[model samples]
Target chain A: MTLTEKVLARASGKAHVQPGDNVWVNVDVLMTHDVCGPGTIGVFKREFGQHAKVWDQSKVVIIPDHYIFTADSMSNRNVDILRSFVHEQKLPYFYDVIDDPTGEWKFDASKGQLERQYGSNYTGVCHTTLPWKGHTRPGEILFGTDSHTCMAGAFNQFATGIGNTDAGFILGTGKLLIKVPETMRFFLEGALPLGVMAKDVILHVIGEIGFDGATYRAMQWEGPGVYSLSMDDRMTIANMAIEAGGKNGIFPCDQKTLDYVNERVAENGTKSEFEPVEIDAAQVFSYDKVFDLSKLEPTVACHPDPGNRKLAKELEHIHLDRAYIGSCTGGKTSDFLAFAEVVRGKTVKIDTVGVPATTKVVRELKEILWGGQSVWQILQSAGVQLTENASCAACLGGPVDTFGRLNKPMKCISATNRNFPGRMGNKESEVFLASPYTVAASALTGRITDPRTFMS
Target chain B: MAHTVTSPVYVVRDNIDTDQIIPAQYLTLVPTIAEEYVKLGSYALIGLPDALYPKRFISEGDISTPYKIVIAGRNFGCGSSREHAPIALGAAGVEAVVADGFARIFFRNCVATGEVYPYDSPVRLCDVLHTGDVATLDFDVDTLTVGGTVYSLKPLGEVRPVIDAGGIFNFARQSGMIAGEAPSH
Candidate 1:
């Protein structure tokens, strides 16, 4: 059996399981954010009775990330609904956005967007916060309301996204009925060349297989290249498993995984014991593919769809009006480090925006130095407009005033995931999705660019 | 579960993602709320680019759509796991969607929520149908008729009973997977 099969089998208390076996698996952690939390809570109340409590408060995590920074009343009301639900159920894992005594959603537009944070209780994107807050564990079944919840699979777990209805059922039952997906093995070997990142690799894979390539299957990354990537890089790759219609994307847990999980868990003061599962020797993969990471160049997913693949160098003629670096996929410390390396001491030709994925990442940007200057200072000097608060600002194109959102029909090069039409605000606007290096280079030139021009 | 749905069809190209089905900016409207559910339907498919799609799926200031079926190319309802995609369509009175393929999560949401019937056509239906064309879907034989041409649809198989019973919760109750009766939405 593959690692996914083993993890599901153990979670279901079964001695053995196969690809197509439908079983009821115990859920270790269930997450919902502001977008889906209120709806899920409503379904829970309607189906389980208005007075019913959640099955287990400790295992339920609620993060208010999307649309939190906006002033939209409906968005604010949604967060309040989550707050009341958390208070009612005594759920301890809620990261709230409103800290006023009245519990009213408030934002100070007078302050810089970065300084407009409500309080420290607020985290940013849920996918990044899951690992940062130590909610992700190996061999655990993590279900979230957001599609990007598959990002947690990088921690060597069975993680997938479900809609509010399924989440509502899990809230009352602590169990989910799921079928064991067949595994599609991706054997990545060789080291990635400089200027190419995990985003490029996944974009390449998605392009090769098309968007629905791995539908109804688990994508398992293996070989030496998978081990060589940092935990952040692994997270970036695993975050986009759904782009290729994958049920989940998993990697074999090693010392790096153990070390990162242990550090975060210790810092969080949450005690969790989980067994790491490995692919059985007799395991058979339904599909197998390999990528030679060393030969990869900076890649991009052109506008309209993520699978519309193109090399960054091949699209230098595509002019852009703006550049953005933020989201659960690209707004990490590692991604910023890569971006700063290219944009350091250089001015941007286009309007460039930088948003950290979390409040912790916000601090890291101010503390982490490059060439005697902090990343924050370097980015500021390079003319990148950095937001003060760490939230998913404009990544999903929240409200009209959302920072960095494209309100007009203009072209942009972004480090975020998904280039679907209207994904970043305006329907007619085009987005070129690329790595931080590529985005940084493009910000400098005002056109799609290859990072190698700025590197070495 | 024998029924027939006849209505005007809205045609779209391949990869009609969830963002196009329901944009992220309007996601704040929770579908469980009675009024917001209708409000969500008002904005269904509003994300389609004006140049590509000249016709709107749901007209301005209207809560429900005139079209009951949506014909699409490959990979319909892709991107994002927002159940709002299916909910928005269902709230807009979309009874069925026929496409060459579907994204995994969106299709699951359609069945789990009992919002709409997701049907797969052996051929690309979008190529054969137009936005204003009339289409009739017969649930009994799993066939869609458009302009006197009949096309066979992939059977719902194991999931038919669930949709017939109005979603997973009710199906689970009937199948003994859980206790209690289905709630009235």
Candidate 2:
């Protein structure tokens, strides 16, 4: 059996489980954010009862991230609704944006786009926060309202997104009926080249097999190349599993996963008892596909869809008006380090935006130095508009006032995930999805340039 | 439980992600709110580029659409786990969606909410049928008739009971998984 099967089998309280079997599994965590938290809470109340309580307060995690920095009233109201729900249920894991219990929390735009909302319980994106807050554990089943919840599978756990109805049911029962998915084995061979990133690796796989390639299937990455990657790299790859319509993307839980999970769990004082799933000696991968990491170059997913793959050199002629580096997929310390490596002493030709995924990452930007300067200072020196407040600014194109949002029909090379029409803002705008290396390289020039140009 | 739907179809291309179904800017309107639920329908498929898709899924100044069914190519309702996608379609009175294939989350959301009957068709209905074509979906015989041509649809099979019971909550109540909860409207 694969790692997914083993994890699900344990969660479902079965000795052995196979693909295509329908089982009800106990949920360790159910996450929701501002975008879907209000809806999920409403469903939970309607189905369970007007005054009903959630099954487990500690098991439910609410993060108010999306649309938080916008001046939009409705977005603020949604966060308020989540706040009310958290207070009503006394849910302990909520990361509140405002101190006030009422719905009067407003985005003070006069303070500037990146300022304000300082030093609150606000943790940026939910996917990134899940790991940092130690909500992610091996051999646990986590269901979140947001699709990128699959990002937690980097811890070798079974995590996927569910709709509000399913989430609501879980709120009452703490159990969800789910069908076990078949696993698609992806073996990454050879060490990753200097210019290449996990974004390129996943883009190549998604391009080889269309956007719907892993639909209803689990993508499990293995081989020696898996160990070569850092936890952040694995998170970046696992985050975009949904781009290929994958149920989840998983990696082997090695020392890196253990060390990261242990530190976070200890720091956050979360439940530390978790049994990690291991592969048996007789285990076999039914469907195997290998990707040569060394053979890869800086790749990009062109406009309209993430499956439209092309090498960076092939698209160097494509002019770009903006370069954005942020989101759960690309807005990490590692990704920023990659960007800083390319654009250390150089200036950006086009408008570039940098948003850290979490407050922890925000500190890392100020602390981690490149050459002699901090990453934040280096990016600011390079004329990148860096946001002080860490949140999903324009990765999904929130409100009109969202920072880094492509409001016009401009061409943008982004380090974010999806390039679906209207994904990052205007439907007419063309977004080229690439890694931080490619985006940073493109920022130096007003065109999509190969990161290899700066690497060597 | 065998019902038939006869209505004009709204056509769309493949890879119709949730963002196109319902854009992120409007996601602030949670579908669980009845007032926002109706508003969500007003903007269904509003994210489709004006140049590529000239015909709007929901006409301007209207909350409910004239068309009752959607015809889409492969990989329909892709991207994001936004249940609002299917909810918006259902709110717009889209009774069913016939497509070549569906992304996993969207298809499951459609079934879980009982918002729309997501039918998998053997043939590419988007290519075969035109937008605004009058079509009839007969679940009794498991066939879709458009312009006098009949197309077979894959049976809902295991999920039939859930949709018939009007979503997972209702199905759970009927199966004694949980008691005292009213069915979804």
Candidate 3:
């Protein structure tokens, strides 16, 4: 049995657990959003005749990341109710839209001027902040109320999304049922060319694996090639693991991971030392897998379904009207730097949208734009729009973006998580999920083009 | 193989998410909604003088949500698979859920997360579902109806076999799927 198998088995409490066994692994971390939090709390008191907290306070995390601007009075009320609950419990972490007057939140909306009720400044998409602060470790199980909770799996842990009830028990008692997931090994081989990115790789994987093929499974990305990828790159891959129903996407701890941990520690006041990664003994992994990255050129998963994938070269004379980069996947400094490196001095021929999750990301982008980076100059010269202070704005269609008098059926290549129908603002519009480099190249060529082709 | 609960189940709107079913702030309240664990959590804090959001926080004794079937609008389970919803609903004394539609992923969560009965109505619109009617869900046929509208929900399938055997874990224990070698796929 491999480490994953052992953890799954132990978490599920089986005498001996094996692959393909479905058990509800105990949730190590549970989180929620305002829209859902209020209703969940309402049900808790209505049902259990009391508050449900009898479990570990350290384990459950709550963040009202979405609808920060208070979509309406009702939405605002919801955020408020969730906030009070977090304050009362003193749950180790709670990122609210309005910070307390006393000032103790990780991100204070009060600090920002434009951080409106539903503005982008309060909290980022839960996925962005979880991994950003080093709350996610390598091998622990994490369950988030949001679908993108699978993003934490970048640390080689089994992370997945769960509904509120599952979160309730994990919050009430330290246990929940879990299914032993079948391991789907995706072998990465050969170094990715300079222009291609992990987003492209993941999108390509999604295209091949199909939207529902890997549902409820663990995607273990391996091969020496994977090690070459940076932690940000790995995060991009793991972030969307949920697209295919996989529990989490993971990569082993290596030098890149160490660097990420070191940098994160220095940035935040958390412990600087890297805790030894936990390994699960007594577990076996399914060998069901696939490979062929050298042949795997940069790719995109097109509209309606993430499963609708095609290589950039497959679509001829592809003209993209919009290219968006910035989700938790593409918002990191590395993604921007990579895009800057590729599109240096080159202006976007098509309209572009760059949305970052955090103020820091915005600040970093501003520096790049003002620092005479070619990409920045080109973006300014071009009509690219930057929608700042929105969480999953472009990814989930919160109207953070609007193009004036554009064609009805707009086609965009983005570096977000899912490309499901209407995931982006335009339901009729076609969206192709891909890497930042691919998006930059697509922006330049007006169609999906091989990112490598644009390289110097 | 069947773990039977009471007959008439409480119906609910589709997508009664973990958050709605069990608010995150209240999760740590410990034995009483009236008591704040430490500081007022977000839900309560909203009622505070300085709330980031509106002040519609549910004060203690805001009419306990009556345990009955909740008839919801279409595309009910259209969000993350937060187990809190179902668990809270179950804890709230909801016998069964009846919805015109359910999010596909959340449907599976109902059966896996707890022992509650999740029934889908076949009718396009569960127009009959009122706020307080009892929801009777028949897992045997995988059907749910409130005030006469039947919901068409998918069967739990593999999960159903375990549920029939009285929860997946219990079923696994009885069948020795974990004790012995894994059953052949």
Candidate 4:
């Protein structure tokens, strides 16, 4: 049995379980964001009734991240709906944009300016913030309404996305019927080459597997290569599990996971009783398949499909109209650090955007100095358009007029996941998915240049 | 209890994600009212190539076409876990989807919403079924008959009741899992 099977078996209250066995497992946490939360609330009301209480208030988390900073009335209304629902239900875990305790910035509707408030409250991207807030833990079976929710699996938890209907049902029942998925383990051995991050490794994996290769199966990552990755890198790999049609992508809990969680807890000045779930030694075994990533090059998933990947060096002929580095997949602190390293003193030739994953990331960027300026300041000085705090900006391709939107038919090199047609904006526009290193390098060169060309 | 449908299947290739079913731009058009939602059903698979199938799922003047079944390749509904995808298909009068395989969330959404019945074809349905190919689906025996040959389908198993009850909520209501009058907002 693999670690995935062991986790499911325990969650389902069975001594052993096999693939295709349907089991009703108790859920520990449920998350919904602005884009999906309103729809989920509507479903909950329609099916469970308007006044029906959620199964467990404390266990439910709502974050209004996507479409929050947009001027669109519908997007704002979505956040309003979530706010009202959160208030009406008195949900304990609603993280609003205004909830940022830093109080450094506030969106002033009247002046259309981000003003300083004494004490503001806001949580950025839910995936980045959830683990930071201790909403996700090992051994827990969590469900979210966004496809990227599988990202929490980096904590060794069984987390995946479900539709609004299932979310409503889980809200009412606190249980979801799931078929135990066959696990497909990828044993990534050997250290990644310089200028190659987890994003490159995952892009390589997705390209090899195609978009649907791992459909309906648990994608588990293991081996020494996994240990070489940072927590942020691990999150980046797990975040795009859905890109390969995987049910979930997970990494077994390790010291890195523990250290990251502990540091986050300490930084937040909050106490958590959360303990990392222990792995059963008997469950460890040979993986389904293994890939040596030592020689892996910086890879990019070309236009139209994330599975259409090529070595970044091979794509230097492709010109970029825009370059973006942000999203759950590449908007972490480390991602920004990597981006800054590449574009340190270079001026971007094309439109470039850098959005931190959360408020904490922004704070972290302020600590790093590049060329006598903070990382964020240097990025802005280097002609990178940085957004306030964090949100799923153009990753989903917002309104035609939204910043970072693919308004025109042009090519863009992005660090975000998913390059499906019309994914970032205009259907005619093309998106190349790459790592922050590659994106920054491409942004400086206005072409798909490999990070190694500039890194050394 | 069983349901049967006979129609010319519209064949779509592999990995038909929710984004392709209906792009994010169209999601805001999905109204909360069921009636209004169905009105936008014509937009189902709107992003797909028009040259492939000349007739739209929902035709001009908001009239729906006659295609009731969609035969697809593997990993159908692989992307975003949006109920709107299934809802749009259901609204477009698509009664069932026959695919080589399905993404887990999309499969569960089909069962939970009871909007569309998803049948797993043992053989690649895309290769076996084609546009204007008359096919019959029998939910009772879990089989799809194309031309003169019949293909066995994966059984719904425990999910049958939920599908039979027209969704998980209905099943739960019937089984006494939810008791009491619908809450007034």
DockQ of each: 0.86, 0.85, 0.12, 0.49
Ranking by lDDT: 1, 2, 4, 3
The CAPRI quality class of candidate 3 comes to incorrect
Each candidate structure's TM-score, on Cα atoms with residue i matched to residue i, is 0.98, 0.98, 0.70, 0.91
- Residue-level lDDT of model 3, residues A54-171, one tens digit each, is 3667666666655443223444555667767766677766666555623322333344423323333255667777766656765567777667777777776667776554455455
Q: Pick the candidate with the highest lDDT.
A: 1
Clashing pairs in 4: A98-A121, A99-A121, A99-A122, A100-A120, A100-A121, A100-A122
**Each candidate's fnat, in order?**
0.85, 0.86, 0.22, 0.47
Those runs of model 3 whose alpha carbons end farther than 4 Å from true positions after fitting are A10-16, A20-26, A50-54, A69-71, A101-123, A262-287, A367-382, A399-409, B1-104, B112-185
Candidate 4 lDDT, B52-118, residue by residue in tens: 5565665677735477999898888877877788878887888889898887788888898788888
- Give the alpha carbon lDDT tens digit for every residue of B1-185 in model 1: 54999999999999999999999999999999999999999989999988999988888778889999999988888889999999999999999999998988999999899989999999888888899999899999999998899999999888788888888998888999888877787
Off by over 4 Å in 1: A100-102
Candidate 2 per-residue lDDT over residues B16-102, each given as its tens digit: 999999999999998988899999999988999999889887778989888888989988888889999999999988888989999
Off by over 4 Å in 2: A100-103, A284-286, B181-185
| Candidate chain B TM-scores, in order | 0.97, 0.95, 0.57, 0.89
lDDT of 1 at B161: 85
Restricting to chain A, the TM-score for each candidate equals 0.98, 0.98, 0.85, 0.93
Encode model 1's per-residue lDDT on A28-129: one tens digit a residue: 999999999999998899889999989998899999988877767888888889888888888889889866423877555556465657686888899999
- Can you give the lDDT of residue A33 in candidate 1? 94
Every candidate's lDDT? 0.90, 0.89, 0.58, 0.80
Arranged by DockQ with the best first, the candidates are 1, 2, 4, 3
Model 3, B1-185: lDDT tens digits are 23232243323332233333343333333221333312222232121111211222233544223443445544444334544444444444444555655554565566654445555455644455443455555557666555676565666566666545434334554787434322221
Q: Which candidate number maximizes DockQ?
A: 1
